[model samples]
Target: MRVLVTEPLSEAGLALLRRDFQVDVREDLTDPEALAAAIGPYDALIVRSQTRVTARVLEAGERLKVVARAGIGLDNVDVEAATRRGILVVNAPQSNIVSAAEHTIALLLAQARNIPQAHAALRAGRWERARYQGVELAGKTLGIVGLGRVGAMVAQRALAFGMRVIAHDPYVPRERAREMGVDLMPSLEALLVQSDFVSLHLPRTPQTEGLIGAHELSLMKEGARLVNTARGGIVDEEALAKAIADGHLGGAALDVFAQEPPGDSPLFHLENVVVTPHLGAATAEAQDKAGTQIAEMVRLALAGEFVPYAVNLSAGAEVPEVVRPFLGLAERLGALCTGLADGALRSIECAFLGRIAEADTRVLTLAVLKGALSPIVHEPVSFVNAPIIAAERGIAVSEVRSTVSRDYVNLVALRAETEDGEVEVAGTLVGRRERLTQVLGFELEMAPARYMVFLTYEDRPGVIGRVGTILGEHGINIATMEVAREAAGGLALMGLTVDSPVPPDVLEEVRGAVRASAIRSIVLPA
Candidate 1:
């Protein structure tokens, strides 16, 4: 096997890669064509932020089996393109929590003490102690947003400094909050009003971009300070500058920005603001950890084992053999239920029945979550990270086991509770094939294929015929069909596997023709 190292990495990581493969080092390949040509022969590629794994490079590497990033973010890699090519993209999400948490606290203390401003003043040949008087973190209230790994660490550190810690994360369970020894606020507004300092530790996503804009800043206390070591773009820079300029906010400490290098921002000239060059994960320990972890994942992936940190796998469960065959079914069931679901997910319950239920099912349960959230979350969803994502969304998760089954020897049932309501899907393995056995409360068995349509409508005659006619008119062939209902003139669900995805116009036409209560297309990848 061959491995390519395209950027600076820890000696520990390089040594690990060298143990099993022929290694090449090329940190100076900045040209895309050069990178594309150079990457063709390597079986695995390892990189840090310095290298961009472009689509051209991935395409050129016909032998590439894995692309391992040394850090958490995939902004520098073309993950979608790699996924399309069936290349494993893996990262170390656990490498920098402590470093980022410590950095956030460092910035918080600096902001409270006006450390940067005072140092600058003293450097200019002035010892004005009276003019540099600053507040203390002791006896202050600290509010944390997005109580993920870093946020939880920050809470612990703040408590050690005698600061009262409160948090606002929609996804964190109240029990988890209690375990963290922090008060959880129901909303961000409530948290900001009660806090003397606010820190952000959330990933930047469509929903969280500019999360703390004008109105959000206005909700803060008059003397509150802000800290961001998470990502940029979550705080509106323009709004932050205005808030500081108008005396609405005390100050802000930033380690990241909406734009790298943050060229010509008004906040740069503000004495109350302190900034860093995004050094949250700059510590030696963090780099080494990230490098070695990513190296190990790449090694496993190259050996054809399931890498727990992979971004594109539908089934990452490493359960026993008896339970392994059902992992694909579990994942697909999760994805199907999630697509059919409405509103934000609130909870997920994984129920294992019959023989497989007696075995350990933690991995199976996580597969369900990974499958359900992969379609919706901006962050990469995997069995290793899905529980955290669900917690971040305040979604409760549980696993249930039963030794009895009506038909199959083993069955996996997935139930999702969203803001709207609950939806249940169950599946089993028939010989070597996975089969969808139940939906809602109706029971029927069918091996779900690649492309399918799911619909619920009034259980009356002519509805099925109208749907079939509409699909036929659109040139779609039904490969298999399964229908279920509780009573004669009530609601019924029909799932039909088709040769191709139905177009929007055709689906709309079918809905209109049959008066479908709900209808959508689902693709279960083989």
Candidate 2:
């Protein structure tokens, strides 16, 4: 076996690869074409964030069985292209947990004790003991925004410092937070209102892009401190700067930014703000762990053993091309089910029915999880950790395959059970287009759209007209509608696509007018 290393790696990792296979270190293959030309003979490739594993590059690796990322993000790699080629991509997520968690504490202590400002004042040959007086962490409240890997660690560490720890994570089970000895707030607003210090440990997703904007920052208790050791963009820089300037916030500590090497920003000039160059994962121990992890995974792939860190671990080597097209559909169904389930998720079960069931559908199961949790999670949910995240929250996941797809080439049905109720959604691919054909137990047909309305109503005279009339009355334009029912005067399901999102009050009016059994406004990006 042969392995190619396109970027600098720890000697510990290189030694491991060299022990089992021939190794080539080529740090000059920054060009995609150059990397592709040199990749044809290698069975494995390793890189950091610098290399671009494009589709053409993957195609050039004729013997490639694995692509390993020695860091956290895979932005430089084309994951979908590799999955289609039956290649495995693995990364080490655990490598940076402690580093980031420790950094969060460092920043929190710095802000609380005015360490940076005090140090700067003394360095200028001035005695300023009285001017640098700071508060103590003991008896203070530390609120964690996301209780994932880093956030969990922060809670444990903060508790040891005699700080009251409260958290807010919807996907995490209440029992889990209790086990950690942390109080989980019911909502972000609730946490903000009571916290003396707020720390963010969330990803940069559309839902979380401006999570700590003006409105959220305004909800914080007066003179409250803030810390961000997670991704940038999760907090609005402008809002944070204004809050500090207005004396509404005590101070802030930031390690990441919305843009790397950010241009002139107001946060930099604020004396109360402490910023780092995104060094959350910068530690010798972290680098060594990343290298060792990727090396072990590459070896496992070559030996045909199970590789747990693989981005497509659920995808078996025998997954057929016919079933690949429906992967997106399955994810959409899962996403839709979660959006309507209403409460903390408990379990997920997806069944593969019809001719497509002949092949293993295990790989497609992650897509369902990705869709279901992406809507609410603060991190990028991937095939690699979706199951892990589910397990951490005590959520059960199972996949069943049946050789009966009913009138279609293949059908995927997914169900998500939450604390409130169970929501089931199923869909299938028609030609190249994927459409949802079932919601709950109704046989409805509709394509996934950015804006939609899912409702159940009595099958009676004027019900359909009444729905349309109520929507029009509220100036909500219906783009399209699909309806299916059991029988005359029986219950019916209506899936409608609208020009824009249906406001809560408007949906309530429609629900009241049509006497809906249940109604939910859904948004699924097309």
lDDT of each: 0.83, 0.85
Give the CA lDDT, 0 to 100, for residue 227 in model 2.
Answer: 99
Cα lDDT tens digits for candidate 2, 1-526:
9999999788899999999999999999967999999999999999986789999999999999999998776657887788888898888877778988999999999998889998999999988999888889999999999888789889999999999999998877787889899898999999999999999988775567788999999999999999998878889999999999999999899998888768888999988889888788788998899899889988988988767677665343434677768767877787788778767788999999988888877768877887777666544466777787777767899999988766777789887777777888888888989888889888878888778888888899988788889888878898899989999899888889898878778888888888999899876734
For residues 7-102, could you state the per-residue lDDT of candidate 1 as single tens digits?
Answer: 788889889988988989898775667889899889999887657899999999999988888887776788768877879888887787789889
Worst 10 residues of 2 by lDDT: 311-320
Tell me the spans in candidate 1 whose CA falls farther than 4 Å from its real position.
30-34, 314-348, 352-363, 371-412, 416-526
Poorest 10 consecutive residues by lDDT, candidate 1: 311-320
TM-score of 1: 0.74
Off by over 4 Å in 2: 1-8, 19-45, 49-67, 75-88, 299-307, 312-330, 352-367, 374-384, 398-411, 428-435, 446-481, 485-492, 496-526
Backbone clashes for every candidate come to 4, 3
